[model samples]
Target: MSDFLQTRVGAALKDAALAAVITLLLASIMVGLRTKTEQGGLVIVGQWGLVAWMVGVVFVGRLAMSLLIWRGNNPVANAMNAMLPKQDTVSKIGKLVGPLLLLFAVTLPFYGNRYVIDMGILVLTYIMLGWGLNIVVGLAGLLDLGYVAFYAVGAYSYALFAQYFDLSFWVCLPLAGILAAFWGMILGFPVLRLRGDYLAIVTLAFGEIIRVVLLNWYEFTGGPDGISRIPRPSFFGLEFTRKNGFADFFGLDYSSMHRIIFLFYLILILALITNFVTMRLRKLPIGRAWEALREDEIACRSLGINTTNTKLTAFALGAMFGGFAGAFFATRQGFISPESFTFMESAIILAIVVLGGLGSQLGVVIASLVMIGGFEVFRDLEDLRMLVFGLLMVGIMIWKPRGIVSSRAPSVFLKEKKSVSGDLVAEGEG
Candidate 1:
């Protein structure tokens, strides 16, 4: 091997060792030693096997990743890459996948069991939030780490209104969205001049502020205990109860599955609406402005585009959809809590947007399914799930930061019909 290749392998080995050491420390502290109650007495037990397994996985994963990186440009790999499909072909395949996934989602409840349906609901909720954040972070180039605050706002809005005013879910749904949008604009005002890490800090602080308020103001937000027994959504004034309910109205036997199915369809419709609106907006002038702002705010301003309005609109509309999803979440769970709206929620949503491919709607759907659905599959490995996922995320950030869907179709094309590959436009410049 060449000296360069030897150096690469050496660096890879060193990095893998470092990663293994770090994993050993974390796993040992978190899982190696644990407390078990024996006869009403707390006993410290050692689970060294689990810690060893974690370290082994980390070392192997990091070493393999390093080797892959080093081999990426080899002649054999180049030949294999050449044999792969072209960008246009891949884009066509992505388009086909979107419709198929939508069809599957629409028909899922019929074939899926309760657990499957519940996971579907959770996945769809993330998809909706991903699409919403896509408007700001993906299109407008704003870094919003506090996007979940709007989600909490929408949930609490519905919960409070339903509890105090006896409002229907339908009524509170729009109100919740509007309230969340209002808060989105409120967040927008403070960080108008901020960009990059500064922008992220402000947004993160905004989210924490919202959470702190919800946590401390026990009289209004119910504090950490949260608000429970919130009303469930009925179909056009039809309850899901035993008598005069959905089944009785239709002369069918009542089943709790009815509500689950309703929520499934309800969220599906809302997500579709969000998708349609975003697609349409992309064709409008404002949508193009968002793309311009994302590309280079200074140039966008030089072109006489009002940056202030563009940013505010992106924030407000994004927050609106988040609120919509939040309202649905609240009604579906019949509870609202500060714990549900944390910084981690924002990170996960942003991760979906980043991993899926910024500004690619289909990418968001694909990534949400992989990340969210995959998380469920690894539910048994709760101890190592986050560690493994964090490592995977780190690997992606280093190797494939452009995301799974590295190519995206342009919103606007010339009369000559030019093509724009997403790689031509690097994301996160803002």
Candidate 2:
């Protein structure tokens, strides 16, 4: 009995087998069949082969992970980590990565095809949204499940203002952000006393309320059909028209690619601004209060910090950036719809913040790229797409539960600033 209990391989095998069986039971029905429209009708084609494939992948991944965690028997893992570069060297490389990635993004429009550029725009938009949500969920330890409300508010605000007031995109941009922030404050006020799951539920309800209002307010919001042909932003008062467009003004031949490139740059700039402000805010007294609030609310109050203002500012600032991203989305798409701002959008943004590392700006970027760009990469997987994605997410959580960038540099420090592992920080669930 002692020998059996001591066998790590036996334990790993048992655990992996149990996990595989559970996964098979839960996911088999959905993954093992496919619906295809035939001349006769919809056909339920058997995809048992893919089902087996998915289950096998999960089994192998779980086995590997279990072996790695076999009661302190993973010397390979410890040695590998020990062999990695020192923290200081890694920090230098991390600094270079941001600049190098930025350079690549800036140059992509010039060399990449249209599809790549479009994906870049989409990725940057999510990056911006993730950073915005980081303020509330990451820094302030507020769990907001319905952040898309602010995003919808921003998009519709710009669309309505432009349509009724005849305002250009430039004029509507800040106004949209302001309106969204106003709504954020409104949300903040009601949920002030709430925390944890209660706060999340209320925030989720707020998002649904906005969505329902947009769906039903047919006269004002255009209902499910959505408002279309939103005025696109011009290049500094110069339209994208072929006659006096940006290309013509610059003495270059006109091409539709100009608009795509412009949108890419616009979103990139917005993302950078969001990143910059978030970084600066991390050092401010208000920001420190946010972190304090995140770490321990009771302690924060005891330390003379205004918890109400801290939470309100977190919500408002986060919503403001979300509004900015939403405005860019509306202009880039030339349309606005409630469907585009669904709970799934909020979930994805939150996932980025969590999967990256709460309150880590660079982590948000890496997670956004992996999640958003990787979505396009796996589009071809079809029925197995989600199954594959689920497996990857499970693996990530097992290996790096705290996130990829698990260390956080303190925003304020009495001595030299030292990197703190994210494991020490609160998960920011509330």
Candidate 3:
């Protein structure tokens, strides 16, 4: 028995040593790849290279320890194995409902105050935009740098319709979505085969094309001055304006603040609907196909997934959401401008998705809040605000390289657990 134990220990040590050596080698390679010589003769490190090296080292170290424990017949391996989360942690409905309810609970009271309501509306707008972008970036795994084009399409669709036909906000909303979706399909068809950085560049160019068209199409889009005095949303037969608002119609005191609050909640509901629909779609077969496609497009094609339809659907869906947000924005602001749907807007929305963490709804929400909220807060700072914002983003990236809300791996077969009802351990275990 003693000799057997010694042999097992010796084997474990050998395995551990091999793993450690391999880990170091990989780390060295990463460092070599990431290291850059500056013009000033200073050594600079690439972010990706540094992240890979650190992660590789940690992974290797963990593997070596595991190997050592296994070879030594150490009972601690059982505990370590148990510490790992189950693969099916997403099956519980409570996991989905709890966080959502919490969000609503925390945000509901702000509806009473005009400033708070406006902020809420802005947050919801970004949330809708982020979710829309998520369909392209998260579900479809298409990197779109020109997502603002769809937004521009939607906004302009509303503005044009309202300006030409005297259409109401409600009437233009669906039309805007339809138009945006149509344009998304148009954009998607041309770049169906493109992926990664190439796709991003093409999308960026497409966005520029759309913006240039808006700029040149002066008679229709109102040129750089944009369309103004676009109507706000009305309830039943009552407009939200001070004279004909619901309060006045109902013989109650009237305030423009009330109208703003109403609009806020309206957009909030719309955003919630958008989020709900997206989450439900994710659980459907199409959603599964999207995940598969995201993981490996080639494998998805091999599995008989219709990549073309998948790509088109993603674009259309994403554009539809953008259209919704755009229409709401036009109504809320009482104006529409090309400046509202620029490349910078696209970059900001994309940044929200990337910074929030790809494929994470909650992450997008938090990221939007941070990015947009920060922007609102920094409005007073003027020129220096942008610099500070960029620094904040850099800091966040350095601290949490994956994102603010990092992408979570999907559960295979496990039931979902609510964070509120169960302890984190229990949630993972179940």
Best by lDDT: 1
Misplaced by over 4 Å in model 1 are 1-84, 416-418, 426-430
- Candidate 3 displacement at residue 256 in angstroms: 0.6
Model 1: weakest 10-residue lDDT segment is 414-423
**What lDDT would candidate 2 get against the real structure?**
0.89
| Total clashing pairs for each candidate | 0, 1, 6
Q: Rate the local accuracy (lDDT) of all candidates.
A: 0.89, 0.89, 0.77
The TM-scores of all predictions, comma-separated, are 0.84, 0.86, 0.72
Please provide, for model 3 over 1-430, each residue's C-alpha lDDT reduced to its tens digit, 9 standing for 90 to 100. Answer: 6565467555555555566566557666665446567787867564556655565666666566656555335667777667756634533542585487547735665544666667777887898899899878877788888988888888888878988999988889999999999999988898867877788899999999998888888988888888998877888768766676688888888877767777777887788788888888888888878766776777888989998899889889999999888888888887877778788999999999888877778778878888997789788999999899889899988866666655354534468632221111110000
Error of 1 at 144 (Å): 0.4
CA shift of 424, model 1, Å: 2.3
**Candidate 2: where is the Cα deviation over 4 Å?**
1-89
User: Best by TM-score, which number?
Assistant: 2
lDDT score for residue 210 of model 2: 97
Overall local distance difference test of candidate 1: 0.89
